[model samples]
Target: MNNLTTEPDMHTALWSLVRNNNKLFSQKRNLEKFRTLLNIISENGTIEDLINIMSIFLYGNNAQKELIENTCLPCLRKLPCEDLPKLDERLRSSISYAGWNINETTDWKQKPSLFELCILACHPNGYTRERAVTALANHYEPVALAIALIRCNDWVSPIRISARDTAVNIIARINTDELMKVWIVFDRVSHGQRHGDISLSKTLFPLLRERIPSNELHLQLESGNSRTRRYAAEVMWHTHQSLNYSDLQALCACSDPYVCFRTMRDILPRLDQRVRTKLLDLVKTKKWAPARLERLRLLMTDQPECMHDELLDALCDRSASVRNFARFHLKEHSDVDMELHYQRKLESPNISTRIAALAGLTEIGSPIVADHAKRWLKEENPRIVAAGLSALPAEVIDNCEDHILKKVTNHSLQISKAAYIALCNSPPLSAKITPYFQRDDLSERQSIYFANLLLLQSRWEAVAHAISFCRHNSKEVNKCGVFWLQRWVYGERKFWMTPSKSDLQDIHRELELSHSNMTEALMKEIRFLLDSYQ
Candidate 1:
């Protein structure tokens, strides 16, 4: 046999096995090549390689059957059961029918690929997978059984039944050592969705709780995948497995957010005062926003006296939710002048702080917010200008309508967009922006914004503006015009100020000229409106 050490060599070996080319491998040499192939696959092959190997084992010639029994099956048994690759839809459908060909009377002596069969239990093909599940019955190799457990959630009905039944029977009689090996796969599968109401894990949890040792559960909690760690934490808590302060601290520091949150929620309350305080302090330093927010909540409810400083510090947290949470609780608990504090923060060099302060002051309805907004609008920094525009009150906007209108054409799209949005709220200011509709230099988005603003007005001129927008070069703007025209035509006619007969005739004339842009259906609706209204 060739060494098959390099990638191309490996590919060639796998291709030979797949084709079952007897010329390449004599009877003895085939066994050696098969052993080497399984070793290489188990060590470093990707999911594609595994699929290829399974194809050969399941359907390849029986020349290497003895080698597969002694070498291939054992190597497969050790393969970790995790999320499998998605198979092609065409292949899944095709193999489903192929499963029917496996004779029902085939005895165990004839089928030696038990581990391969276990993997096939999850094959994309439903019937093939169901047949795999049937073969997996009474087989308790740790990885094999775990794969069967995963099929409990299979989208197919009979496969789910067969897999669940197999797991139920084996779990009842399976020993602790085998169960331990199955634990990681089992815990992971439990978190996934199921096909029916039957959950073998829920039924088996108490049995696992009794049979699995405490040390093993702790090991799972300390280190594993997110799903396994989370499940371990739940099992430990529900089973009342005692965790010392260090264990609690480790769990609190877990990278997984839910595990950290769950530990704090379920376990922290019952700990001694000193331990809880230490844990809270530890969580306060963690960068995760949810954890920090949760810590603030715990402080507010359990230790209000210690909450004042934390609340003030949290007011500037990078996360908006954290800052808002702190502000909401600070109002009731602390007598500090929040408005004055926010006003001071507006001058801070940090842009985020300035924005947060502006938001807080706006929410508090501070009289000084409008003055700050006026100043921010004139600043060279566009972000500051945006914050000001967003916070600028409706009355303030009405007074500065001209200034706001000029900003709609600003070079900075952000500032222009903010100015456009500000003007949108003041319907009386819509006339000032009507001239902007003719400006060809505006971007597609700005053109659309202006068109939408015109649609908001109840006046007949707004309908005329919609018609004029139809001729704009941008297809999206033209589409916007067509949509609003349809709405105005189909909508209640009496509610809006009716166009004079001449205005109606003018709109009808514009629609006739816009035939290339307007859909036939829309033109029909417009014609119906004009004939009735005239």
Candidate 2:
């Protein structure tokens, strides 16, 4: 037999074996055909062929499994070596087809044992855990799916996506308390999206809406656990179906303040005006504790002018949420009111309210308001002073420059930051501010900001004056000076002081001989700079 006749015969024979499988591993043709079959279909196979190949590998007989275990799997374990490049190339193409079909292999009729999944979930390879998490959607066992959902968050990007989408399957169908466990998992991570972004809402929200008639979702919404209830309130408005009006009324009157607030913010806006009015009437008559105060929001919505006094009274409400609501609502009105109705609010006993009021005045930008607010700078309350600094008009800013420079080193960080930001804007204040950078009481951060400003405005002599603090007794102060030196090297064109090897040497010489107290810290900083530069 010549090679030509033998090759075609071999191809025809192996394809026939693939079409009808028996555990016939005895032939060398089987091994060559297996690799050949994967390679031919690997790059350009039809969807049907890919599916068949996937099923072959996943549920194929012992010989096919052994073929992968011995051949492509070993090559894929490392990068493509030069000697056997064809093997590496074929292995990679085959593995891509294999990975693409992981979700299709899930057996919904029987949940895998916890021990098996635990190993996959705990696997160091991200792709393995990704497969395990995504496969949970077809899983029949609720508790097992819940456990896998928690582990999905630990995997890489692909796994996290599978975890998020599969979460909807578990969330929509799971029983009351079971879904709460998923919510607990969600809260541990920082990101959750609604609509077209990263959230269980894309599926779970619609499913919950569909399943509402079952009362299962309702039970979770009203769960004894506050966290579960909170999740319900948060996600309730995201569904395609509107929440039932009676359900909204009841949740608004819920004992949980968080639930009530969430209902008012999310659910109430979509309610009919007549329904809100009727609910407000019923709550006012019934004196529902959790929701009675929520009536102020409706009043603000329908008759905002009539609700001004009531909102003012709410500012004193003991609940922080209520106070925040009042502050925000009042600021909204202050935007339009020529009277600045919240003026009295600047003196409101609550510090947050006072800050909000001052901020309102700031945005309004009335010189008259600044005149009244400037007294806040002298009041000794640093928060009030900070607000005053932010609220002042440019015309009035110079009048307060001397006072602002003093507060740059004020014990209150908020006041000091406001003072630094305000002075940095006024070039005249730069002269007055430079000397304070060297004062022992000044914070290192304060000095860095001050020094940077001087350089930013071409005040080279000021930075030269304060260069000694690079070896200051305060470690924080020394660190700040070193950071400034670093900024100079990175080459900011606006600065007056440019970094040079000779210039740094001269400064180092002065520090070593003139300042014996901080030789070590200074040397450490210089060495770090030298290493980084090189």
In order of appearance, the predictions have TM-scores of 0.63, 0.48
Q: Which segments of candidate 2 are over 4 A away from where they belong? A: 1-143, 147-175, 184-203, 206-235, 238-266, 274-365, 369-371, 395-400, 427-431, 442-469, 492-534
Which 10 consecutive positions of candidate 2 have the poorest summed lDDT? 76-85
lDDT score, candidate 1, position 166:
79
- The global Cα lDDT (0 to 1) of model 1 is 0.70
List model 2 lDDT by residue over 77-148, tens digit each.
Answer: 222111122322343355455453334543434654332342344344467666666666665344445444
- CA RMSD of all predictions: 8.1, 14.8
- Which residue pairs in model 2 clash with each other? none
lDDT of 2: 0.56
What is the Cα-based lDDT of residue 184 in candidate 2?
A: 49
